[model samples]
Target chain A: MLDAFSRAVVSADASTAPIGDLSALKAFVASGNRRLDAVNAIASNASCMVSDAIAGMICENQGLIQAGGNCYPNRRMAACLRDGEIVLRYVSYALLAGDASVLDDRCLNGLKETYAALGVPATSTVRAVQIMKAQAAAHIQDDPSEARAGARLRKMGSPVVNDRCASLVAEASSYFDRVISALG
Target chain B: MKSVVTTVIAAADAAGRFPSTSDLESVQGSLQRAAARMEAAEKLSGNLDNVAKEAYDACIAKYPYLNNAGEANSSETFKTKCMRDVKHYLRLISYSLVVGGTGPLDEWGIAGQREVYRALNLPTGPYVAALSFARNRGCAPRDMSAQALTEYNALVDYVINSLS
Candidate 1:
């Protein structure tokens, strides 16, 4: 029930990070908090974002929405969307925590096994996660309203290559890569 | 197998819990040393066959009695087994190095060692000697960085310590 900020703080309490690294983590967290609006944006739009993405995937894989497919029934379709949301939520936790282990252990560790057992098509699920990842990264790093602006222009106005925000963004994207690989 | 440290972190993560400061440090350290570890792993892995042959020759020279009748070193199977074990340990070390973590070498690396040896009617001493020689000779690569060498030694020594 804790808000993402509270959750991030709570996760930060138990750490063996060295003095300097702890400071770095603290700074990163502070900077991340400034960017909390992205998480907020994603949270606010998650359902529609997930549904639209999955609908596209389902549309392309026409057989899937037909009889006896992995997501044949409307109920299965709903489950797929729900699972996508769950994955997104956990990915957000890892983004805030600056660690991939959370996503790895909770969401992805046995997912392939579970999917196999339940007959979920991994390819569709992977595509869905990829869709979410792209959307989330866009929100985190860019303003959709300013679609014409180059992402580089935004960076040019700020820190250099070691830009903390850029680094965190890369880290966040890596989580998506991790998830995609796990599902793939 | 996963590193013990990563496994523990995974447990904490599953509980939706935060990390202890040490855990953060550990994970970050792995990230920092990742490149060097992978470098060392590449060097060792690239020379796997050569290292095995060199280590085997050295072991035989040091303990000629192992080549006697009824001894493990005398049989082609046991000799092959020695090569196989070397490859296994080296491969595991390479994984740990590339991953920048000292995985549970004891659990996945050295575990079942005795059973394998017994099954092959192998002597522990010669096998140990050959492994030590492999580590010693294989690690002598001049191109490896100090950090890479340190990381390499840490993993191989960890396996040796567990066994010896």
Candidate 2:
């Protein structure tokens, strides 16, 4: 699995190969690294933004106006934020490590805690996570290179690395879903 | 305060049942008054040693079932339990008022539950599950059994009576 992941990552890296000048190739790699750093920053904070957006949507739908006529999430929204943070961290770890197996039983238990805290069934929790992902995706969509950078980060955290990290994270999520269902 | 209590009682009597969407305006009025009274009491009695005792006595007086409930021995404990139960009941009521209908309360999708949480100005995390549990247990007045329904009404009335 690691060999195939490595080859895939190497192939993806090769696709961005610079022609002619070695200095140009170095510059291209340097630029990609900068974009990757930006992507990481966005990814790290995406969960909080998603949680806040979800809370805003809820507050708007329910007409929960605060003293200032502005709606804000209460403590419960904090729980959702916590859950999102956990998922994002674990998924990012899995991607960076290029091994979903790193998310073991302990990790699954943590996921369960989020599901329980969110007070929704596993399926509903999954839907909520999907919504978060969509929100995150939308936020970066306007910047095509940044979006590509994010996509690259998912597949491989750095352009220099050669591992299908994104696929591992996807598998990790599926594994999480199975475990959650089994827990039920 | 007395007028608010009177209004809630009158509405309960007129409906011949616990308050529902049919008399939502009255229900909302009672809810707002109850909330106001709680806030006032909390503010006026701030840091007072006997505040919990007073709240306990008031709650037990209105809903005797709250009295002698095992393990709620101290005034503070009793007060805490009473407030928790009251909040739970009130959230359900708020959910019904905002969401309407008695059609499988637990089945409210993410959007639906969000609406309920938002309507109550509640936090959106564990409380969502808590609300889901209440809905699953048929906490809506119409969904309750005869005895359960009576107890629910008594609980709401107790809040109105205590606050007023």
Candidate 3:
């Protein structure tokens, strides 16, 4: 051990790293930002994303429109829908920032209490977030022949941003997991 | 049940490296906010009796049946338990304020509380309302930064959510 330590103390190769190549690092960062931009593509139609998701949730749970349910009262329905939009807005923020704290701190920090105080339904809210997650992932999946997100990324000159698209979708999906678990 | 230490360790465990500079900065931010929280807690720590009294008074005013002496679950017993809980919540909030997180409340106090209240046939509304009273009646001392106040409100809301 003493011999090895003496050898290491005398070694320049072990202490010094070659610093000529940076393309790999640059490519990594560029790809990461590209994936982020791909995720942000879903941002333009955020209202549609949230509304469609909530529409699906309300469809599955029709009781939400009936008396005594959370969405039954006109004001209650507005609040429910507004909250869906708020959640999606925050989810988008998290996705774009590549961090969950923005969503956790701003929108979800006291959301449970606010929901309980307003008698908002947790189960329905959970489902709405899930639906949004699915829809957002769909928007990230690249399509070669249309009916998918292929045309969206075609401007970047890649017919197959396949793995990149898949990873971006995966990251986007996980942010909603935080929301679901927060409500859970 | 997240505190600065647990949160940093978890992040490091997730990424398999030292917690990054951003993580350290986030901790610093929480600690900065915590100074305000500590001051707020100190203000409330000395005034527990007055805070608890006003909370009970406000709750009784809102729900008069709580004033009854004859009803078993509806009046005296419920009032006593409710007031006790409200007092504990104020103290718990004080503790949480100093800790700068809800870790204490979730781990030590509120876990599984929803079911406990349900099993006891306790009305959650009264408890929730009493908590609101305790905080709004100035148990959450007025001289707090907006950031500190938001953190305090979040903990109170967390307790209310657990009950409801």
Instruction: Return the top candidate by TM-score.
Output: 1
Return the TM-score for candidate 1, rounded to 2 decimals.
0.55
What is the per-residue lDDT of model 3 for residues A20-116, given as tens digits with 9 covering 90 to 100?
A: 2323323323454454455445655566777888788989989989998778789887877778877776665555444576567767888888878
Q: Point out the higher-scoring one by DockQ: 1 or 2.
A: 1
- Interface RMSD of each candidate, angstroms, one decimal: 13.8, 30.1, 20.2
lDDT of each: 0.63, 0.38, 0.62
Q: TM-scores of the models, in the given order?
A: 0.55, 0.28, 0.43
User: Second chain TM-score per prediction?
Assistant: 0.81, 0.26, 0.82
Error of 3 at B12 (Å): 0.6
lDDT (tens digit, per residue) of candidate 2 on A76-145: 5566556555554444333322234333432555666655674544544455555544444433232224
Best-to-worst order by lDDT is 1, 3, 2
What's each prediction's clash count? Answer: 11, 4, 1
Error of 3 at B88 (Å): 1.2
lDDT, residue A2, candidate 3 = 12
True contacts kept of each: 0.00, 0.00, 0.00
